[model samples]
Target: MQPSTLDVTAERPTIASVVRSARPALGLYVLFQLLAFGVLWLLSWKAGVSPGRFVGAFDGNWYLSVAEHGYDQAVTVGPDGMPAENSLVFFPLTPALTALLGLFGLPLLPAALTVSLLAGCAAAWGLFLLGRDLAGPRVGILMAVLWSIGPGSAALHLAYSESLLVALVAWTLVAVARRQWPLAGVLAILTGLTRASGSALVAGVCVAAIVAIVRRQDGWRPWLGGSLAPLGLLGYLGYVAIRTGRPDGWFWLQGGWEMHFDFGRFTWIQTLEGLTSNESSWITVTALFVVLAVALQIWAWCTRLPLPWQVYNTLTVVIALCSSNYFQSRARFLLPAFVLTVPLALLLAKLPNRALAILLTTGALVGAWYGAFLMAIVHLNP
Candidate 1:
């Protein structure tokens, strides 16, 4: 039998329906943000730190500097006439957006805040769309609300690339599901430009496309979409190389920052032994968390879920864990950790309304607390 065209009147919910459907999730998301803000404020007060102190802290300074001044290879050199890894660390997208926003007379801090918030909202909307595609409209709203209230949401308030990246990835996945190959590829490429981990999306899409080709599924669209995923990432890396007169300049910079990926492979036993030491408690904890996340991905894969979604998520977790340069704070870097929510959403759908409400409330509290602590640390230290 021929597949019927999607009925818009049947699939698209009314505005009133969407709002009424989203109310519970929206309320919970707001509560999550408020709680996070309150907790962070309290922590800052106790630590004798001001909330403003956290505004443009950590890597935010680098991005702001890059926005004010375009790329200069000389900027990578420190007082010792040696290139500092952190100097070349700026990614193109964030600074470019900052510069664009500055045309309107907005300061860097405010611009960052505005862009991040908008990106975050866009991400939530994308997640909602993805959920609606994969599960149902109700689940879609739940997924969006959960994402908005998750620990990762804190990235929106920072000058980091997480919010923008999440928005791109979520929408890219949505496009993939709809078989909009070119759109998926375009978003995937943008995602690559957003962050290093974005390469995982490229890989995932490419794999999915290859699988489709091998199985003789719809051909041209998948191939085109998959092919475009790595272009933005590779193009930017090439630009960095040309500017630095070193083909591997980007890789070198990542290494200089001690983000080396080979430590686990080259010194496996020693790495494990070191991690067991008291001084390496943080490393041990991070390793454990990464392992747990990887395990979750494996479980998802084994469960025979949708092939494309499974591949996308599994690759993301693998890259986060096995990639050469590992950071302890990377525990939160698993922003794609929201993939776990797919299953969680399904489970919640089957639960009683009261139970689902309780679970969402608990998740919001945890997410808020995590976000607050992250902000405090980044601000106070950086």
Candidate 2:
């Protein structure tokens, strides 16, 4: 007897599953990105700003400068007597890619944007891989879509390190989940090379390595991988130290940019100021998301997310949020904290098609508009 149509359709295909059945997620990510960027480009055109000027605003300009000219002398100083927006604070990976592209005769800003766009796609693919492993194909697609349209998502398209860092971090975590220690180590190193948040990835890998050792898996691989995980971050810091001839040069340079880590006291002050001050409502919006992120970190811990993911996500949020100033960019900084989306993805995955469509449609519309506004109206770059 032949199988019924239902049985036949239900049986998974064997020969061509398309990257082991992640095509849907990849397609969805691409679709959402195209739609959102199309809207942003339309807005930029209306405002008479070119894509390069619009996308490579703020730190994008800094990265481009670093790529073209390398680090400049720190002669400029702000009122706080700190280094003023120097290039030393940025990690080398994204800028290095931009510089390499420039060697092929590409313009500096365009090369940075190209690197960011490619890295953003990679990040989306990695998110799909991890999301698929966590749930199923549709859930994975939803995760990718949500990320592409999430707050600060457009920063993925801009010349920011977030794109490459997220890609490296997501794939690193995926490797951790798969117990591929060597791969995880390499990605973790690259992650550290991409952004300061690479510290979180290194910590996550260390946690995973320790967990493996505690589970009685006697292996030199775990120790060796753990040892290599932090080299990218530590090595960069060492380079900065030598360049500045100070053990604390990086932090001092960040201070010149009106940025510093103050152990959450500064964040609490900002939150309180936003809540109490009436000069602007957007301040409160930033505070709300900061609070929401903290809550989600707690919620993730309570949920079934892996220990490594939990550690990494929490540390990333802590570092990203508990810093000095830049309240406007807090939401953008939270874009790659993909672990926070797991519970929402699980809940959305079980919803009816109509409900899921409504929720995601709302998210896409709102996120795209908000990001465009940030990209166009303010000095803030998404």
Model number with the top TM-score: 2
Clashing pairs in 2: 82-256, 83-256, 155-382
List clashing residue pairs in candidate 1. Answer: 259-325, 260-324, 260-325, 261-324, 261-325
Candidate 2: which stretches are off by over 4 Å? 1-20, 45-48, 72-80
lDDT of 1: 0.67
Please write out the lDDT profile of model 2 over residues 1-382, one tens digit for every residue.
1111111113444646636676766676667777778778777787778655677778888888889888775646667666676788888999899999999999988898888877877777778767766666666777777777777777877778887888888888877776778888888888888888789889999998998878856477788778889999988988898888889878877876678787878778888888788456566766776787788778777677677888898898888887877778888888868888877777788888899778887787677767776776554655
Tens digit per residue, CA lDDT, model 1, 83-195:
67654556778777888999999998888777776777677777776676666767677777766665445555667677787888888876776667889999998888888
Ten-residue region with minimum lDDT total, candidate 2: 1-10
lDDT of 2 at 319: 88
Estimated TM-score per prediction?
A: 0.83, 0.90
